[model samples]
Target: MAEKHFKYVIVGGGVAAGYAAREFSKLGVNPGELAIISKESVAPYERPALSKGYLFPEGSARLPGFHVCVGSGGERLLPEWYTDKGISLILSTEIVKADLASKTLTSAADETFKYETLIIATGSTVFKLSDFGVEGADAKNIFYLREIDDADKLVEAIKEKRNGKAVVVGGGYIGLELSAALRINNFDVSMVFPEPWCMPRLFTAGIAAFYEDFYTNKGVNIIKGTVASGFGTNANGEVTDVKLKDGRVLDADIVVVGVGAKPLTTLFKGQLEEDKGGIKTDSSFKTSIPDVYAVGDVATFPLKLYNDIRRVEHVDHARKSAEQAVKAIIASEQGQSIEEYDYLPYFYSRAFDLSWQFYGDNVGDCIIFGDCSPASATHKFGAYWVKDGKVVGAFLESGSPEENQAIAKVARVQPPAGSLDQLLNEGLAFASKI
Candidate 1:
């Protein structure tokens, strides 16, 4: 086995790893002292682009363009950027074993890596239909999107099954986005989910209604209160139909599964303190082990705004948390201290011509406002979550940049929401005033 050592090592080359590398460079990291081990052949790019613009029928997003920092409206960092910074990009390397006690990681190729400091940013993996014993789920053309390779395979399927029918199994972020992408590719699309409405976790029924209606208007079929029980494959072993639990079947040339995802923390299981199905970390993203940290989808850290401990899986948290962890690391080296990671939960999604942003926790009474009619010329509307008479969360659809900023502020400040009727009448004005 070949043995190498790095002063600092990041064990995943996804959004958090890329952003952490950038933070290291910004903080004057020494050349050759840092290494990022990634299973991906390419350097980290924006993962969200995979399900959105990457599958577009025209002028889709491509690598080098959607790379880290760019996704957060900063300079794009290419693979060469790592070389120029003297940060080792150990691409196409999967660490099969992580021994935190010895500060060593062994790759599948039997390469041993010793690190003085390690950052775990393995992100998450998608749930597959086969995991639930859905028969014939492994047939060709049945897909899940989590990595660039997965997106590439999906792109190939779109080309191969042009103008064919697609069934999206899940009504959450992936399902909604995939359905839109398939529809954009001019494929007949149907969405199936067991939820009463799409995005049941975040969007209120009123909020989901507009999107469900909008998707319906785009000629996409929406099947609710059911799940994909099984799959039917043709002689060529390609997915031809999706059998629902509700005794319905839909034709599908390609079946895309977007059910959900779990954090990728298997390698460090039982070795690290865990909470909420992720590695537990402090506000600085420091894990239980010394000189070890976890970020992105795998770190269940403190949410200062909520006065609680939680894990956020979105890109914004990924970028911000990585930066926070790196900053904490550098500060500790200098015998200096910085503020805790104070984060306000923010989530957003875009598909077709509509974009929506949500800020803060979504629990509490929801106040729906503005024109949410799917047929309206402009689907400008929002929802507010008021808890204990204060606006704890805000959701806005088709909001301008300024309007979005206002809503973010509202969520952070958490201004007292007067009356439900007042909030409904004030609408965007409520956020703007804050």
Candidate 2:
């Protein structure tokens, strides 16, 4: 078996891995000291783009164009960048075994890699209907968007099934984005979800109503309060229809499922402490084991802002947590100290001409403000989550750059909302003043 060693190793080449590598480079590294092992052949690019700009009908984003850091307005680290920095890029290699005690990883190809320090950034895996034993879930033309390969397959399917019928099974971010993309590709799209409204976990009914109306106006069918129970397949094993639990059958040339995702921590099961189906970590992103850290979607770290241990599965957290983990690692080696990560949860999504930014905890009584009417020309609106008389969270659709920053600041500061009516009336101005 082949064997290798590195002083620092990062597992999983998603957004977190890419950012961690950048932070390591900034801290200073020696030749052959750092290695990144990933199941994907390509280095980390913006994963979120797979469902956004990557699906654009024209001028779509392509690799090397949307690599990590580029999404955050930083330098794009091409493959050559790894070589120049003397960092090993072990691509298309899946680590089947992780021995945290020995600091060794065994790849599927029987290669063993040892590291002095390890960063686990395996990210998350898309939830598949087949996992729940849904009939005909494995039929062809049924897709799930999570990785680049999945996006490529969807793009190919879109080209092959142009102007065909598509049934998206979920009303989450992926469903909303994919439905928009399918529509852009000239496909008749129908969205299905079991939730009462789209993005129910974060978006309030008032906020969701605006998006729902906008989607309806765009010729997309929204089916809620029910779910796809099964799929009908043709003789060629391609999906032709989606059978809903509510006794409805929708003709479909393609089906896309985006129910949710779970942290990809199966490889390290029983080897580390887990919380909320993710690896438990401290504020510094340090896992239970020494010399090992976890970040991104896989890390359930302490949320200092909310006084809770939370796992944020958003791109913003992925990037920021990765940087914090690397900084903590480098600082410890140099006998230095850094501040604990005090992150205010941030999440956003873009579909068609509408965009929204959210920050802080989305718990408590939500107060919707601004103009959310679908027919309104401005289409601008926002909501504030108040808890214990403080504005704990903020959400704004169609917010300007400065306004979004102000909302984020409001979430972090959690200013007192002396009067709900006054705050509602003030709206964006309340956050702006803070």
Candidate 3:
């Protein structure tokens, strides 16, 4: 078996891996000292694009164009960049075994890698319907968007099944984005979810109402309060229909499932301390094991701002957490101290000419503000979550650059929430001032 050793190794080539590499370069990592092992054939690109622009029928995004750092308005690190930095980009290598105690990782190809320090950036895997024995879930063209390869497959399906009926089974970020993408491609689209409103984990009823109305007006079918119980396939083993738990079957030329995702932590399951389905980590992203750290969706670290532990799966947190982990590593090496990670949860999505940004915790009493009418031409609106007489979260749809920044500040500052009438009257103005 072939063997390699490096001063640093980051497992899983995803958003976190890319950003961590950039951070390492920034901190003056020596050539040939660091290596990144990934199962993906290509270098890490912005994952969020897989569900957004990548699905666009025209002017769609492609590789090298949306690589790491670009998503955060930084320099794009293409494969050449890794080569220039002398960072080993071990693409298409899946680490089948991770021995934390020996600081070793074994690839599926029987290659072994030893590292002085390790950063776990395995990210998450999509929940497949087949896992639950959903009948006929294995049919062709039944897609899930988690990686670039998955997006590529969906794009091919979209072309082959042009102007066909598409069913999206999920109401979260992927479901909303993919549904919009299919609709944009002129496909008759229908969304299926078991919740009364989309993004139930974040969006309030008022917020969801505006989106549901807008999507309906745009000719997209919204089927809520039911789950996809099974699928139907043609003689060719291609999905032709979706059977819902509510006893309704809808014809579909393509099916996209985005129910949810679980962190990829099985390799180190027994060796690492897990919390809430992720590896438990300190504010610096260091796991319980020595010379080991975890970041991205796999690490549940202390949310210093909220005084709690959280595992954020959003791209924003993924980028920031990777940077934090690298900073912690470099600081420790230099015998210096750096501030702990203080993350303010941020999430956003765009579809059908509507864009929204959310920040901070979505807990406590939610107060709707501004004009959220789906029929309105502007369709500008926002919401605030008031907890303990303080605004803990803010959401704004169709906000300008400055306006979005203002709401982000409102969420971070978490100022005292005044009277309901006052807040409603002030609306965006309230955030602008803050």
Per-residue lDDT of candidate 2, residues 77-129 (tens digit): 99999999999999999999999988899999999999999999999999999
Please give the RMSD of candidate 2 to the true structure.
0.8
lDDT of 3: 0.93
Report the C-alpha lDDT of model 3 over 259-361, residue by residue, as the tens digit: 9999999999899899988999999999999789999999999998789988899889999999999999999999997898989999999887989999999
**TM-scores, all models, native as reference:** 0.99, 0.99, 0.99
Show pairs that collide, candidate 1: none
Identify the superior model by lDDT, candidate 1 or candidate 3. 1
State the TM-score for model 2.
0.99
lDDT (10s digit) by residue, model 1, range 1-434:
66999999999999999999999999999999999999999998989999899999899999878999898888899989999999999999999999999999999999999999999999999888788888999999999999999999999999999999999999999999999999999999999999999999999888899999999999999999999998998899998899999999999999999989999999999999999999999999999998999999999998988889998889999999999999999999999988999998999999999999999999999989999999988889999999999999999999999999999999999999999999999999989988
Candidate 3, pairs of clashing residues? none
Model 1 stretches astray by more than 4 angstroms: none
- Misplaced by over 4 Å in model 3 are none
Q: RMSD in angstroms, candidate 1?
A: 0.7
Q: Considering only N, C-alpha and C atoms within 3 Å, which residue pairs clash in candidate 2?
A: none
